[model samples]
Target: MFWEPLRARFTREALTRSFVALRIRDYRRWSIAQLLSGAGAAASQIAIAWLVIELGGDGIALGAVTACMMLPTLLLGPFIGILVDRHTRRAVLLVTAVAQMLIAGVLAALTFGGALELWMLMALSLAHGVAFAADNPARQLLVMDIVGRERMTSAVSMNEVIINGARVIGPAIAGVLLVVSDAGWCFVVNVLMFVPSIFVLLSLRPVAPAGRTEPADSTAAAARPIGAWRFAMHTPAIRATLLLAVCASACYNIAVVVPLIVADVFHADGGTYGALAVAFGLGALPGAFFSATGPTMPRSAEVRAMAVAMAAAVLLSAGAPTLPLLFVGLAAVGMVVMWFIARANAFVMLSTPTAIRGRVMGIWAMALPGSTVVTGLLIGGLADLTDPRIAYGAVGLVTALVVTLSWRGLRSAR
Candidate 1:
């Protein structure tokens, strides 16, 4: 069903070593750029979610929009991975940043002009997803370029720190903007963040360690997506790693359900919806730190254990009878969620050979946000027809079962 990380106690030595990757200049620059870009992305997500709510859209509309946003990752993933291996990562990221900025700018104008229709938002979501399909894997490969193999796990964990940091700051900004202004202003903030991020990206150069690099092959035919997918499946570690991502993918994406919770269960406003996300982001920081101490190659047992912990946390949230309890449950979920993802990513990246790493990572990405194409419907539909709580409970229960049934298989390797 699902699997991921849990390991060595949080010793003082582990704590001190976590931030070591930031000591590298290029990684630091990349982190800052990612922080800005990730924040803008997060803010726009909040804006989009709020817009759906404002538009009188139901769970079905929410699921469809989410599906559109993630679909390109599934459809374009293999081809994009091949492209990633063939081209320069920084150039791809720059192009994506500019494209996403334009998309957000268009939405801002539409919002200001009072011309946004639900179909328009869905179409834009598709366009934005197409850009992100290129953005996600290229940025991931770039991290390896900056940090190299030895430090990749810690670097990835730190990257998760930046992402969770963005989650905290971005939604908080959106919460305020949405209250004082509207989604149009939030989209403007998205546009502004991209401008500086593009400049930061332009200023940096990345280098890989000798002999640890993906070969200098510039041909798309040199590293085929199909060959990569075959490698991932035939290899025990990668196959299991991909499976764990699928299992965990079922649990998170609470954004789709959070609004439904605030409106249907808590009878709260947009601000409360944002506050719940803040609790989640806060919890993720320590979890990301916990993951930072792990080796570049993760342990399967630990992966399985962490997946269970994450599932239990989701089920806990499902049973929350009060708003405060809901916050606690979601916080617990955030903790395990980041912890698992950081380790899982490290294992996948380290386990694969550099030649096909891009393509395999593409398949891996599909299991993540890409898998959301199918999951958005399941979770959103469950909430739509029944209570939102059922959606949460189903996610938790199904994930736990997947892990339990696949216990022996997950114990294999990467």
Candidate 2:
């Protein structure tokens, strides 16, 4: 009798806690679109990196390409955020999806024709980045709009789970495609994958900005672009989160650093590189799910602690003497990183007023990837000059120190 009641309670709790966002119809549709788009993007990442290497690009060249992909976010994030707040989010998403599809198609055609050049790839990366600036803020705000603050944390965590799960599957698929054919096929597949996102986006109901249910002229003052920047600057929690995000971006330049490690340190092939990527994704899956299921800790301290833990994990990966140790370190890093990102995103979403959420998220979008442009160059140059391991260690140590010193301030923000 005791065991039966206990099991019944546990089952009831599990059912209640699982995937809270899926209960909402629009969020479900949006999530499906995100999954397909995320997977396509992940696969394209592998294809793009491999293409650059095939075209005689080195570490710096690869870094330049990565930087180009992120530069537009840094440059155009504020403006795009303003637009996102002013326009219907679903419309913004539809336009971005279509733009991305067209860009991928052009890239695929060029690759197939054997006429693709490095400059052409960089130019396309810029265009892709521009599309992302609009897409990132709109999609993030749309989740908030659909689910509201009560379930925002679970919704964001679930979204991360989908994206990271796709990260695992996408590269594995790309690895297989690379074995049979070439990078162009991966781009071709990406083009087709975008179709679902376009369709789903079309079906979603239009989302109005917060406070925009009133007359447009009356709300225009509140919707001004400068207001978003001012709010983020004055808001303690948002300000600290953005700072931490930039620091995290520097430490997170593992995308560039890991490939170098696989090639130079481990002397591994493409398959091993894909396996490393999968390891990170696999670790992130549980972390995201855990966050989705229930609360962990106070968002502020939670983010700070995770940042420090992630730094330690990166150092462990940097100092790993063997492949097994390296993989273990990476998995740890992935878990902590995902938890940190989920918490930080939720914290920002919950803390901000819904009226300027788009602009706020746009700032967030800018800070996260914008830092990568600088760190990419730093990590890439360091890898080129000395060793990738040293670069990783330096970045991690610096991140840990910065977060440690700022912990009190971050805690107070809550």
Candidate 3:
């Protein structure tokens, strides 16, 4: 019985991994654009956060700013998904990238002019959030079209590496740039970085649109958007993966808690925070690179491995005591988190039909930022009341519980 199930699953997994559209040139161009876009996004985020703090904004303000940036994924994502299905994805991405550049340019101008305000900052963040909501689904859907459904899993895994690889450098670079000049320079860099993506999108030869057109009837077209959520909720594998992801996000927020711990508990300074982040980044890079090499087991097995890894990371974070110990723990955590992300993304890409790919991905995006935002607020409050260590430890416990409960669903996905 086990043999039969394993064989069947392997067949499906193999089909998912095979790339039918790899010969296409435009797709490669799109991938390059996406890689640059991810890097620019990371740079912009680090810069914006630092800008808030430098302008006398407190933790609460920082949280609000982060929330504003993510809130659109929850609010505008569904409709954006609909638009992605209805519009040319290349056009959509091109417009959004340009819009993002303009938004950053405006902020850069305000900062240079010394006219930036709390409300203006918040408003700009919200706009960026909206742009993100539109941008993400377009990119995800375009990937499917570019690579075809077969190789989507590998493509997604590789994409995660590209994005996170940029993340590893973006914050560190932002730190140095902020020290050298000011937040305005970061925004300026972001604006210039986005230009490459815009050029790539514009230069791509036109292909047939991958998205399906909406029905002529308003009610019919409106009815389709909500179905994506309904479908995800009903799918045991998808639902479980998302639940696991939420837990994973909570566990991953240890990165946030670590800096606070370094300052408050270890009585360290900025260098300590940088060291921990660097260690985490170093560890995550290898993990992401390994994930791109291919599945450890079958695809489903890989998914289950991610769930197990997440649990391990949570426990590691909770058990860390010394600064060196915590760095080691964080490195392990980073490795696992990277693996889990690659596996989870591959699962989603493999499982979803191309027609509804963007909306399904929108649902995926919703779970991540929504969980991160909630956990960030919860952890922030807990850290203030007791200690960052205790707060993160508690969150890790919660994360472990979530992973344990969701193991079966993950197993099925493989």
Candidate 4:
């Protein structure tokens, strides 16, 4: 009787459109695997940062380690994207998964054997970065291949939800593990987590690239290194979207800046910092779901509005007088920022042709980590010279200025 009611409630006509993408079998499998992989990745991030601290490394050391991790995305993203387009995406994903598994295992062994050093960690981070440079584009293109364009927006939004959920859960798990055991165990958990994803990828049927029926000769001709760049440069909508992404990336430096505020300004510990991160992730859940379920709006207006909202939230966070207020501000920031990201991603995907999607996404991918390197350096230097709060305020100001200046172009493009 209970099952009957639940089944009726979930009938085709009764279910929300936001979940329509999950009705596809391959996408469901991919999503589950992505969840596992995302959670492990998130947990590994916490473990890596905590490990650096435990090793008596200071802020500079942490920054260096992070830079090592992101540098490959900046350096190799274009080439990786081209490679993804030229080859089978599933093979790329499998290879990257195996490579990451091996890297994580090595890190775990080194840590357990007491042979892990800062330089070794940096080297491992660089290797992981190289793997991710390929993995990111392949994974994105694979989503489009499985679900097709109609459900692409929903799938992307759900993917963000999974990623944010993992961000919340992973750190908490890492924190607990660190309390009971150590960072090495966290790495071991990460290595084990990759197992399910690898198996899932192996089981999935090959999905041919959508709308891509070009002859081998044509594909080869278009696979030149500068092809993707030329396309992005000449395309107004793509160019505008990427520029907006660049601004969003700079604004996202708040991720690094907020931890500093929690520790230095709020006089809090690691647990408190984790709580704040969880709050942000929790806020992102509803934001992502709303974007997935809600009616489609004008992309330019949505982008501009969300950017303004994020700016206001950042300012509020920077000026927050109490921890409670800060939490509220951070939650608002997370919500709007995620909404912005979902819209921006959909806009880019919808604007680009399927033939060059991987290369375009690669460029988009580059904007994210590339901007991280830029904003990281900028925020770190400014914070050292003045206050973290001031650094955040400056970022917000720049974000607002960039969004406002681009308003007309984005609107006309829409």
- Model 2 C-alpha lDDT versus the unseen true structure: 0.78
lDDT of 4 by residue, 211-260 (tens): 44357666674465478789888876677768767767766544456656
Question: By lDDT, highest first, what's the ranking?
Answer: 1, 2, 4, 3
Candidate number with the higher TM-score (2 or 3): 2
Task: List lDDT for all candidates, in order.
Answer: 0.82, 0.78, 0.69, 0.74
How many clashes does each candidate structure show, in the order listed?
Answer: 4, 0, 2, 0
- Report the number of the highest-lDDT candidate: 1
Model 1 spans > 4 angstroms off: 1-13, 205-223, 235-237
- Winner of 1 and 3 under lDDT: 1
RMSD of 3: 4.6
**Per-prediction TM-score:** 0.91, 0.87, 0.82, 0.86
Mind giving the per-residue lDDT tens digits that candidate 3 earns over 1-414?
Answer: 646633553465543443323345766666566656666666667667556545665445656776777788877655676677677788888888888999999999999999998889989988888888888878876777667767566666667666766666665666566656777877887888787788877776545575465456668657666787888887878888788777777666543466567656888754455456556766777677656655533376666666677677756765677888888888888888887776676577558776565567767777776556666667766776777777777776776677677767666663
| Candidate 2 per-residue C-alpha lDDT over 99-140 given as tens digits, one digit per residue, 9 for 90 to 100 | 998888988899989999999999999899888878887887
How much does each candidate deviate from the true structure in C-alpha RMSD? Answer: 3.8, 4.3, 4.6, 5.5
**Candidate 4 or 2, higher TM-score:** 2
Best by TM-score: 1
Q: Which residue pairs collide, candidate 2?
A: none
Candidate number with the higher TM-score (1 or 2): 1
Instruction: Assess candidate 1 and give its lDDT.
Output: 0.82
Output the worst ten-in-a-row residue range by lDDT, candidate 1: 206-215
For model 4 the local lDDT of residue 346 reads 73
